[model samples]
Every structure is written in structure tokens, then in C-alpha cells.
Target: VRATQNAKSKMAEVMPDVPKKLDDWKAAADTLDQGGQIVSLYHQLAIFTRPSEATTAEENAKVIWRGRGFELNNDTYMHRQALMACLPMTLSEKLHNDMRRMRRVSRKTVANAIHLAPVIGEWRGTATPTLILAGRRGQLMTLDLYDNDQGNFNGAIIGTPGSGKSVWMNEIAWSYRATNAQVRLLDLGRSFEKLCSKANGQFIEFGPHSPINVNPFTVVDDIDRDMAMLTPVIAKMASLSAPLEEVQYKAINAGILRVWRAHGKDMTITALRDLFKTGTLEDLEIHNDVRIKDLAIMLEPYTRNGQYARFFDGRANIDFSNDFMVIENEELKRAPDLHAVVNMILLYQITQDMYLSRERGDHRKKLLMIDELMQQLGEIGADDPVKARVVEEAARRARKYGGSLITATQAADDYYSSKQMETAFQFADWVFLLRQKKESLELLDRSGRIVMDDAKKRLLTSLRTEPGVYSEIYIYSPMGEGIARLILDPHTLLLFSNRHEDNQAIDQRRARGLSIDQAIDEVLRERSGKPS
Candidate 1:
């Protein structure tokens, strides 16, 4: 009010026509007094030239500024104070002293003062970051794959072959284990053999020769929930061509109820298959159902005297009692017909383990890492969607049960190409993208669904890997994002190596009465040309 009165007095005395200017001044002063949205803008202008061409550089700089409609100001008078004011991390005392002599805010502040600079996108991850990673600036940082505030724990890892994807996964699994979390890795490639050995974890090679009593028929306290989960596995076994109708699922459920009523704890695929011999689908109220009978016949291979009887007919013999268990099935690729079927069996069994209660009632933090997520997803058929739904539900609710899912694939086509895989892996809150094909990267750019800033896009496109030394990866995470290097020492690199030669060397030493650790040390000694 005092300023308004003084402005009126001045205007009436000698500047009657300048009242409009006074009004503008009054509005700005009022905004300042009211503490509105006034932000300080900082801009950095870099001028590079040879010492001898300094004069010419100044003239060129002035011309460039003028061309951009910016008036040039010679800072020779207080250059040090002006430059220091623009620099971050400077002391506030020095900043206040430097800025006190600077020009006041004007209409030109927003019009010309804000230009992009080398800003810091530093993210100090979660309070307890599980993994240690180095940022683009070589600053040590931490990474937490799961944060409860985000309410997500699922992760996705994608990369090209030999791009250190295995090493990256080894780091994550190792990091999680360091926190005492229970880890189950479904690795078909045997990539984590050495890491599993080093961790003293079970590296069970699952195959036709190795028998695992994975009974997907075991009852839980909640029979309805158990049926909801078990029905899909049976439906997939009987029908894999297309999606089964609701009636077919109901018939399968009804049949399970009858079998469980009679078999009790002896419920095996063989028993279930045998139930249809004397019993009709009508006994279970599923009349006129040739599909249910056909389903039983289709499961004959899993019954007694059937081809898969030895593997599927037994009770629970496999133990995931250990904290870290790696179930490697290298023979999966050799059997093309049972690829989808086998994947479904292994995944559902693991899901059961995740949901089951222990005798000690200790709920260890459970984590399932699927190394070939896309390939597993690829096994899913168009009409046969039970596999996809199974995976989706498992991942969607894993976080609620003190568990998480981690998936890795070679390309986007590994998951995106299959609708089944897409739905299953889409909830990934943390993603690692190593060097990939341009086409795959395009799909990764949210397929144009979510807009990516140009800076992030450039960083992603610039990703490159120097295998064995370091792998450059862009982390798209719910916590934060940055390009980091997964650099391991020689020991860790050997332990997580997926190299065939390394495996052969380890095997050769083991055949000569050496333990896995002894074999690794011997191999490393041989490579270093040191005597034992």
C-alpha cells in the first residue's frame, strides 16, 4: 500500500503517462511479497578456442548470442563472481555474496536465462540397495531390484548373446543371496554352474535320467485355490492347441474333486488317469464329455508303464530345502514336443514351493529367476493360453507372498512375439537392457506407448559392451534409471562365465578327483601359469 501511494505521488508529479509501467512494477512486487512460484534459472555457456584465437572466439560467441536474440553482457568487471554464482555445490555464503551484486529478476529471466546444462541425474537407490553398481560418471552407487513402496518385485533382463547377460544375472542372484533370500533359478543353459558351485547351492541337472518327484497334485489347506491352480496344468496336458472352454476346465476340476476324494495323498497322474478306466465322466457330473476321456488318454504317457511314468509317477523326492537351488535342464531343447509341457510342469511346481508353508514356519524371501523367459513364453500356443495365465498369475501375486520373479531373454521377440510371454513378463518393475538389435530396441522404447526423453534414448542407443571386462546396461527401474557397468573381477568372471572352454576345463579337472573349487583354482592357476 505504501509503494502504491508513492507510485501515485510520483506519477502525478512528473510521469502521468507512465502509470502503466508503475502498475506492472506493483504487480511484480506483489508477487514477490506473496512468495509465488519464483524459481532461479541457471545457464552455462561454454566457449572453446585456441589461446591465440581468443579475440576471434569472443566475437563469434557474441554473434551466436545475438542470432539467438540474446543480448551480450561483458562480464570482465565481475567475471569470477558471476561464473561462481552459476556453478552448483558452491557455498551459500559465497553464492549470496556473488548474487547480491548481480542484476535483479526481470521479464527476460524466463525468456532467455534457462538453457540445458550437464545436470546430474544421480539416484541414491533404496535405503538398502542389494547390488553395487557404478554410474556413468564412475561413481559407486547401489541398486535395489525391489522396493515395497513400488509394490513390485518382478524384473526383466534382455541382451544379445555373449553380452555378459549371464554375468549380470549372476551378480543379481549373488546379491540377493547375500541378503539371505531363497533363490530358485530355472536355467536351461547351465550358465550359473560355477556360481552355484561357489555358493554351495544345489545345481540339480533335471533331465530324463534325473528323477524328480514333482507332484503337482499335492493338496493344500485351501482346496478351491489348489484346484484353481491345478486345473490349468491338467488342461494344458490334455489340450495344447487352443484355449480350453470354461466347460472343459470345469470338467477337469470336477474330475480332480472325485480323484482326490478316493486317492487321498496317493494322488498321482497315474492314479488320476486310472480313475477314468472304470469311472465315466458322468460319475463326476461331466456327462457327454469325450474331451475328458480324451484328456485321460492323452495323459497315458505319465501313467504306469507309460513313457514318462518314471519321471511323473513318483511323490515328492526333490528337495528345495536349501536356500539356493538351481534346476538346470539342458536337455529341454532336445525335446521339441514336450518343451511347453515341461516348462509348465517345472514352473507350477516352483510356484507350489513358493506358496507352501514350511514345518518351521520360517518364511524365507523367495526369488525365482527364469533365464530364458522369452523362450518359455514362446512355448505358449495361441488358443492354448493356460501356460500364459499360469505364469501371469504366479508373477502378479508373488510379491504378496514374500517372493519375486526375475526373467532374462535374448531379445524382445523372445517375449513380445508371444502373447503368452508378453502378459507373463509385462509386470517387470526393474529391467536391464544390454546391447541389442535396433529393431528390438525400437520395441523397448515402449513401442511408442510411453514417450521417452531424447537424453535417455541417446543413452540407451549408446549402450555398448566389452565382454568379460564390463557390460554396459541401461536399467529401466521403478526406483530410478541410469547407464551402469557390470564390471566383475577375474574370479567372479570365471565363476559366472558361460564359456564352453571354461566348462570343459572345469570338467577335465573334476574327472581327475578334483572338487569344483579345486578344479576352478587349478584352471585359474593354469591360465596364470602358476605352479600348484
Candidate 2:
């Protein structure tokens, strides 16, 4: 305080403008209260002066110090008779003091300190072509797929049940649909019906008796690559508990090659099965131990006279031309025995389409959202090479093509428990961690997907489990990793709503022959009329 007063006095003597600056500060202090006096503080100095013929800058500084009644010592203490500077400890002090370090501040202050703009991770200045509104901070956040030049835009949405994982994904699909991006959902829970209907997308439902043609043998152009892609899928479909023997793999390969050669555009799973059933196994050069008969017997159910033969006997019923498409497996959800095979086939088909779209130079951005991925992952072994290859291939295609994948499940441990699932997680550039179980939280804390400090981990661990519009999440991406609260727009919220009353109202309005927009308006009106 005394040093500051001395400096102010010295400034008053040397400069005429010092008095007016002091007066302005005094006026500001007076406006606050009677006890509010501005105390100017100074420390750490390097003296500089305009050159004068009368004295050097060093001598002038010494004169100013002496005039302020500061004492100068002898040569023993004062190394020079020139200007001296002091780097006071206070001037270099850090803001994180013991008393305030542990306290919490307002979100605004935290946002400012971290430069957390009220925008998405990819928002620089101009709007991005493929990003969608993820959630809100101070404003809406747009999630960019092609970020960091990685050319891969894979993501994972992990949380416990009722944590709004499905809702967030629905919002993403809606946003992309708004921008004319090709959006597809490999939906397990049948949660995308309303959203698909709203978007006028192809809603292809598959069931035990539903005659939906999904021919896996339709992949024929690049036989080797297509055969390689279907290997895991066929293994999964056959409910192969263990990895296929080398000869068994080769047998399946030979059968597929023959089927493609014979059928060409008329390729079907029935024909593929017929090729194996010709009883010409030894002629195909397969090893004695690897029975083509065994594979053909397992695949008999998907043949012409079998239970699922109706679905694979004809050409593919669903096309990928729609902007939004949902391939829902409602029956398989109840039949856990079929999820592995069915999902594998479905995903492999999508993979083929992704490659085809890129090959044909389709510039439209694509998204493949797989909901309840854990169900499918649960059926496959942890270290299954076939599943691993499928995952690796998906990640690779995401890079080659401009498509992004968003896979959601109940827990992070579900992915971590399996090598195939974990590979997919590692390949994902963006990770959205919603309200998680304590066990999943521990796994994620130790995982490489997101590096969180103690404070961040604590915040994530203590997140409220209640689900709503503001579905709290901590997103880890290339731009930065931090907590975000996502709130959907009213129309999107209505289109993909999981609320019981909202669904009832929508159904009622639709039964009255109202259009989707009119149904949404009616629902919104009814909701607004209700008391808060």
C-alpha cells in the first residue's frame, strides 16, 4: 500500500494526466458507497524513459525514487547506480489460491474461462454443411461428423436405460433429415416409427411371418470382398457358438463364389444353400473335417422351405434411395436367438450400401444409427475374429466414404467386455456419455475414449439420473470434451417423442385424419393449455 501511494505521488509529479486518472477512479468509488475508495496497486517494474539531453533513463528513475523518499544503499547492496527493477512475488501470483480453489463458480464464468462458446464443437464462424444440433449450452451445439480431418465420423452413445440415448439419436436423425442427408436406423426397439413416418422415410419392418425380402446374396459385383463381408454375418446367422475352422471358412467361401457364379443377378440365400446341398462337398476340395453338409444343414432354416426362407428367397424389398430409412426388427427383439444373425446380415448389407454409395460418387452425407447394440454384441464372442473384421471394415469404410456411424447401448462395459465392441468404440471420434451406472462410469474413467480430470469425472459421476428434455451428457470430441445439456426443438421433440401422453395425443390426432404437422400442432396446443 505504501509503495503504491509513493508511485502515485511520483506519477503526479512527473505527469500532468495522473491527477485526472486518479479523479476518475475516485468518482467511480464515490458512486459505489461512502467506504469505497479505489486503491491503486503496482508491482514488478522495468523503467523506460524518453531520451533527454539532461539525464539518462537510469538516472531519471533514480531521481524519481529519491524524490519519493526511497533510500538507496551503498555499492555493496546496490550493484549499480543505474535504474533498478523488482519482480515482486505478488505480481506473478496465480489465481488458484487455497481458499478459492475448491469453491464453485457460476457456469458463465466457467464458460468464459474455458472459452466455451454457445455453439457446437465444429462451429468456427461459417455454418457447416453436415453438422446437426446436438444440444444446448448457452445456445444450440452443432455436432460435425468430418472433424480433425480424420475422415472417419463414428460415434457411440452410452448410458443406462431411461437416460435418453434413444431420444438423442432420434434428434440427430431428425436434424440430418432436415438437411437432406441420408439417414438410416438399424432399430431394434422399434423406437423410430413416428420419426420415420414424420420424415416420410421407408419403414421396412421384419418379423417371423412378415414377408420382407432381405437377400444377403445380393452382394455379387466384387465377389471376394462381398464374400469376405458376409462370412461373419453367415457365421452369426448359423448361430455358430465358436469361431469357424479354417476349412469351414474356406468351405463357406467356395459355396458363395459358386452361388454368385451360377445365379448372378438372381442370387438368393436359397440358391447359396442349394450350392452347398448339391452333395458335391469332396469335389469342392474342402478339408475332410470341415463338412459343407454341416453349414448347409444349419442354413436350411433360411432356405426355400424353412422358417425365414420367405425373407431371403426374393430380391431385397427395401431400397436405400430414401433420405430417411428404418430397418426395424421388432420380432427379433423378442427372439434373442435371431438378433446376432439378423443384425449381422442387416449391418453387412448397410456396409455394402455405404461402399456402393461412395463408389457411385453419391455426395450425400450418410449416418448409420444402431440402437441397442449391446443386444447384438451379447450374442457374439468377445474375441471373435469375424466380428472384429466386420467392425474394422465398418470403421475403414467410414473413413473412405463420408458416412458417420452412431451406435448406442446400455453401458460402456458392454463394449469394453468385447474386443469387437471395444474396437468400434476406439474407432469412434465422438463419445456421448449420458447418465451411466457406477460400474460403467468406472470403466469409462479408465478407458482411452475420454480423458477426464478429477473434477470432470466427479461431475459426470454425480449427474442426476432423471431424464428429460435437458438430457445431460458429457461429450468427448476433437474440439474439446465437456458437459452439455441437450434440448430438442418442439417439432423434433414431438416427432421422436417417447412420452406416453404425447404418444397418446399423437395417435388420437392421427386417428382423426390430421396430417403430421396438424397432429403436432394439436398436441402442442394441448400441451401449452395444460397448467405448468
Candidate 3:
């Protein structure tokens, strides 16, 4: 009984101060209600629970009851009865503490789920709905679709062959198709067959037999920056062997400019080659000299005379009148004109289209994915006039005209010599790095101006693994904010997000050219190993 009395004495001391605090709160609440300020009371209540002085039971009861009434009150009545009712002070205190605890628990649960799960689902508008997958060597792979805002996306997959790169690429393609995006793939490795099958008749295969009839030179939507850099080199080569007494190099440039102005709208490698085959020295009013021979040699690399023709001859059955061109050849030739002219034709076409689209106020987004861009650029030195101009335009103005260029290569060192590549790297909104060779990583680090702390270095180092399982992604935004991190597991399969059984059935049906119902039956029959 004596111990209980002492505890009661302590409560009395604490309880008196509570009422005083409540008195002040009551006055404040009353003023807020009369002045039409009660709408903000809930926010104040949330703030008040944090280490403030206690209030009287009567005063506290008013605040608590009013808070409760505020919640239950309809939109119509909430303004009128903002401070009339009183609540039990003890109950209100208990409720607030419980809510705080619940919120903390909920946050922790979501964090854990995100850490363990894969990003799945198609992007709606500009949002990237991704699934993070665990990759080898403590890396995380993420499949993201960045809407270029034209009509297409800048799509990429980072993983080694067995690490699920192919699976992820196919899944992304499938998701894009679901949104009604037309995908034109130049799959040199033939890794997209399963994905192509899923597109039904939309899928077109381009091999040696059913080739694309369009010339790479003619379909200029956007000039590749790398190609632009090669132009001056071609010009220089054209000047090298010209006899001193022949038509000046400036005249040749002027004539070439005239050709571009007159025929640039319909210019293509096929067209240019035709021009060279049928056009004579009289067309440019120049003498036939060793300089002409040099010009021919410089343009030899880009001409259709060699193994390069196989690329033009191997396109699928799709119409290239409006679509982007895809060349499958990887060989590097010595002729500067061949390289320069091919690139020029493409660049001119792209820029011309962009100009027309801009004039018409067309906002359709487009994407140009150039694989092994460095290989093409390396053939043209910095001195090439036409190549230089092409690269400059691609890096600078393509984005304004609703086009985005995505270039991928194995190493950053390959682009070191070309100013065009350097320019693209500087302006590229995003830079993605997968498991890179040490030399390649160093080059990228230096070129991108990346500064790493101990934690970041650790992350980058961890990304380098055997058979290259880990990928270090460096995302640079034109908005000025950048993110660099190590994904512990790379989500390589976008297909895992789909209903796997449904997708498999669709694939089987597509291969057999069956209707949806028939496809379902065929898949079941195949699974059961029975004839349908």
C-alpha cells in the first residue's frame, strides 16, 4: 500500500503538467477551427506527437475527439464541427504510437521485397517498370525500357551469353510488341529466333535468300556521328594523289557539295555507286588524273564491289522505304570513300527526315541502335570531312528532332581515336557498362570522368568476375543527376515476368502457324509427346 501511494504521488506531478499543455492546444485548435484552418490540423497532429509538452486531460480530450471527428466527418460537415467534440486523451496517444510502429514495419517489409525480387512488367508511358534479377558474382541485373519519347525506346541487355542476355532481350522485345511498337531487329547472331516466332506474321527473317532491297546509303533518317567523322578523311584521301595541275581539291569539294544538294534527297550508296559507274569526269568538269584514282581507292571500302554487298543482299522481306537500315557485315575495309559515303548516305537521310518531321511538327520518337559503332568509326580518321560532319550532327541535333542513338561496343578504347565517338559519349544521356575487360573499364572510367570512392570501387571491382557475370551500370541523365552502382544480380530474363506457360504455348503455335485455340492444343500435345 505504501509503494502504491508513492507511485500515485509521481503520477499526480506528471498529470498536472499534461492539462496545462492541453489548455494551450485547445486554444490553438479553437482559433484554427474559427479561422477555417482545421483542414491543416491533421498534418499538425502528425507533427505534435513528437516530443512536445503534455496537455490537460480535458484539453487533450478535445484535440483527440476533434481528430476522430475530423476523420469521420464527411466533406460537407468536416468544416463546421472542426473543434466541438472531445476525445479520451489516453486513447488518442495509444493510437498515434500504434500507427507509427505500423508504418516502420511496412517500410521494412517493402525494402526486403524489392531487394529480393526481379523487376517485371511493361513500361506505361515514361515510367520504367523493371525487374531486378540476381546475377553471378554478387551482381544485380536490371532490365529497363527508357522511352525515347519518339515512338521507340533505348533498349539494352547486359550479361554474358549464359548469364541470360538473350533471354532478357527477347523478353523486352515481347513486352514492347504488346504495346504495339514495331521492332526492326538486325540480329547478326540469329539469337532472336524464339522472340521472332512470338510475333507471328509480324516476324520477318532476312537471310541470304530473301534480302532487303533497300540500299544503306539511301535511307538517311539520322546520320551516325561516327560516319560524319569519316567524311574529312575521305576528302583528304581524294586530295592526296591528285596531280598539282588537275582540278583543285576545293573544286572537287564544291562539285561533291553540288551533288549532295541536288541528289541528297535521294542519295544512297547504290545511288552514289551508280553515279560513279555512269558519271564521268565531265560531270564535275575535272580532269582524269591519279587524284581520281586515289579518290576511288578512298571510296573503295564503302562500295558494293566486295564482301560488303552480302549485307545489302541478306536483308529480310520488310520494306525499308521508311524503316531504319541494318547492315550485318563486320568486316573493316580500307577504302575511305566506301566507308564515308555509306555513312554520309545514312546520315543525310536521317537528318533530312528529322528536318521534315520537325517542319510538320511530328513528335513520333525513333531509336537507332548501332552495334559495334566504334568498328565503323575506327576506319575513318579524324581528318575526314564528310565523316566528321556526320558524327557531329548525330551527337548534337538528333535528340531535338525526336531521335536517340544507342551505340554499343566491347571496349571504350576502340573509340578513342575518333572525335565523333568522343562527342557522342559526352552528350549521351545514359552510359551503360556491363562486365568489361580491365582495359575497357579503365578507358570508360577515364572517358566518362567517373570518380569512385571506396564503396564504389568495391562495387566496380566486384562486378568483374569470371566469364563476366556481373555488370556495373553507369546511368547519366541529361537532367544533371547521375547514378552509379553495382547490381548484385542482373535480371537477364525479361520473359520471366510473363506467364511462362502462356508464352511457351504462343511460341509453339507461332512456329506451326496455328490459331490461338489450335496453338494451345498443339502445345499440350507436344508437352504430352503425342501427335495432335
lDDT of each: 0.72, 0.68, 0.44
Give the per-residue lDDT of model 2 (tens digit) for 1-532.
Answer: 3333644786678876667666654555554565433322222225545556324666666676688575433234332311231333332223223213423112122223344332345323113634444433354555566554643678889977778777878877887778777888988766888888888889887755677777777654587766667777777656546776666677777777777777876887677676666546554555434266677777888778987777777776667777789988766766554656767666767767877887898877788888877676546455666777777777776666678878888888888767778878888888888898777877777875666677667778876444445677777777656666666677767777666777888889899999877898877877789632
TM-score of 2: 0.72
Could you give candidate 3's per-residue lDDT for residues 1-532 as a string of tens digits? 3333544565647666555555545555566566623211122121134344434443564676576463322224433222221232433545545545544112222333454333453212223434343433334434344533333233322333343333434444455455443334434343454444445523333344644433433443334432442244335334322322234344444444444556653543333334344334565665554554444554453346644454343221334333333443322235443444444444444545555666676555444545445544545455443454566576455665655555555555645556666655555655555554556656556665555555655555455333223333434343222222323222222222134554666566667777544665565567669976
Which is the better candidate, 1 or 3, if ranked by lDDT?
Answer: 1
Ranking by TM-score: 1, 2, 3
Residue-level error in angstroms, candidate 2, position 364: 1.3
Best by TM-score: 1
Model 3 alpha-carbon drift over 4 Å, by segment: 1-186, 193-252, 257-289, 296-361, 375-389, 415-420, 437-439, 464-474, 478-532
- Give the clash count for each candidate: 4, 0, 66
lDDT of 1 at 257: 79
Per-residue lDDT over 1-532 for candidate 1, one digit per residue giving the tens place of the 0 to 100 score: 6546756685556866456666766666666677644345444454557899988998888898898687766666766765665566663665664464564223522222333333566655566678887876786777776564665888888888988888899999998998888888988788887788778899887566777655676534455666656777777766666666676677678778787877765788887776555436765575546666666787787777776676667675668678898987667666543556666666766766777744346586678998887555435465336766777777865766667888898986676766567765577777788888877877767764224777666667788888667888887766677788888887777778888998899889889988877888888899999998
Candidate 3's TM-score reads 0.49
Cα displacement (Å) at residue 326, model 3: 6.5
Q: Rank the candidates by lDDT, best first.
A: 1, 2, 3
Could you tell me every candidate's TM-score relative to the true structure?
0.79, 0.72, 0.49
